[model samples]
Target: MFSVIMYHHINSDDLPLSNSDTMMDAHLAYISDHFTTLFPGDPITPGSICLTFDDAYYDFYHYVFPLLKKYNLKAILAVPSAYILEDTEIAPEQRLSLKHHEIYDGDNYKTYAPFCTYTELREMIQSTHVVIASHSMHHVNLSEDSVDLEQEIFGSKVVLEEKLGYRIESFVLPYGKYNNAAVALAREHYSYVFRIGNALNPSWEGIGGLIYRVKGDGLKTADELFNPFKQMGYWFKTMIKMLKGSR
Candidate 1:
């Protein structure tokens, strides 16, 4: 069985969407020693783990990325199409104060940028340890009936590919919220669709194009991440979700 762990910022501030550098070191050390880490295009071999970071925060490039390299682990960094700046002179520290939601304001760019810049992303993509995934344009909630599927779904793919100079193979729902229409459109463009369902993706069989993910951001230690009881909860919920036909 395989599991996909969702993460956000890797900063010293310890915000809700972040993990400190120390905690991140612990996570990578333990995960590297224990399980085989996989990425989107890799085979879903048994016992493989997919370590994915969302929003492509600047701290990820500054902090978590080095840990990933030191540990020799692979990770998928999800980037929202619009938030990524073309280039920036702002200090990464100044940018760190900005959070995901606040990035929507165009006025915010005058000061600092929160998300990864195209320059930074290009550097990471050249490395063997990272792969890019689209997090949609503007990070909007795609389940909304008023949302434009072209811009939020396929349009994001086009933008990222143009900016990063490669095809993006995966789509991660901005808030892990989606409906049939959203999922259907994502399937048309991506090989994988990552969403929060807290279930173990034991295999790709009958999985459609969807790859379910569980929250691992709150975990302080790898022991807590794979606690037997918690793993049982995953198994139990996996059964329930499969039985109920839930995604």
Candidate 2:
């Protein structure tokens, strides 16, 4: 089955929501070992591998881009258009501090740290290997904020298309939280929707599972990427853990 690997940060230090470089290398190595790397338009087969990252973080530009070039792989990056427009560059120290601390919270949503700037995003796009997508206006939780839901979902598409100068067809629901209304809203714009969790195949419950993914952290070694057994073990365990948590 086709498997999309979801990743976040690729920074040197381990941020709270980060995957260490060691883990990232091992994950990619495993792909090279067990499956052939496939592009967006490539024919799909069982065990096909596609890479994706949510929230255009600075580490992706700083760390992940080089690896992508080295391996000659293609991947997608989903970004918060408004945040990128602000052009905020997060330093390692600032990132660590936010991860360790709670920056803000309202209703049940929380904000942690700053993300990458539009400049960095433009730089990433310069690499022919990377494609940009939308994550929403402010990374807002669409499942609960029904009043602003229209703006959050549709507005993001407009912003991203304008900023990146391309039509964005993919999206990752922030926190993997959504309801019927949100889904209905998303269907109007996005062709593929990604949820956060570990599974070989994404949920086919609706338009949600068109793209399935397993999280890959950079903390593991590059060798792990090439080891099918190790990657499978991690994938299975992660899926089980997420299933149990959902229940």
Candidate 3:
């Protein structure tokens, strides 16, 4: 079955949503050996897999990009446009608030890591193995009534295209929460909109709506994914969920 795997941070340190570089290497190696890695716009084939990274962490520049180059794989990066833009330009107070919270490593807590800069993003995109997509303007939950749906959904797309000088055809739902309104808004702006979940989509159909993604952040090794029984069990549960029509 085809799978779209989602990753957040790639680092050696043990932190929230962090996966080690070693484990990432293993995952890539296993995927390369077993599946056809596909890009966002590519026609999905049997046993195809797509890799995606959320949050546009700086660690992805340092850790993930090089490995992608080594493995000759392509991935989509979902970037929160506001974070890439000057923090002062948006909600300065909220930026300060988020910065105050630190991430805990295995031994000690440290200041939260920074997101990738524009230069870094350009470098990655130039590599031709990375596709940049919108995560949102501020990474807010689109389900909330208080949210400005136009700004969060369409605004991010405009910003990324303007700043990066290219059209962004894909989007990932922030927090994986969305309502009918949110879905409609996303459809107006992007060719693909992804959600956090575990299931495989028909590659030939393309991702025009809510595409499910399997979480890769918690995995410690490739073996966990390569096991046939585990793979079947995972798909079996997904099948049950699908039959129930549950998200």
Point out where model 3 deviates above 4 Å: 12-16, 85-113, 204-208, 241-247
User: Which numbered prediction scores highest in lDDT against the true structure?
Assistant: 1
- Shift in Å, residue 198, candidate 3: 1.1
Clashing pairs in 1: none
Better of 1 and 3 by lDDT: 1
List the candidate 2 regions with Cα displacement exceeding 4 Å: 12-16, 39-41, 86-114, 202-210, 218-247
- Among these predictions, the greatest TM-score belongs to 1
Candidate 3 per-residue C-alpha lDDT over 79-177 given as tens digits, one digit per residue, 9 for 90 to 100: 988766332132322222232133222211113336666777888899998999899998889999999999999999998888888889899998899
Which 10 consecutive residues of model 2 have the lowest summed lDDT? 101-110
Q: How many residue pairs collide in each prediction?
A: 0, 22, 0
**Local accuracy of candidate 2 as per-residue lDDT tens digits, 169-199:** 8777887778878777776788767776555
Work out the TM-score per prediction: 0.93, 0.74, 0.83
Model 3: lDDT of residue 218: 66
- Alpha-carbon RMSD to native, per candidate: 1.9, 5.5, 5.8
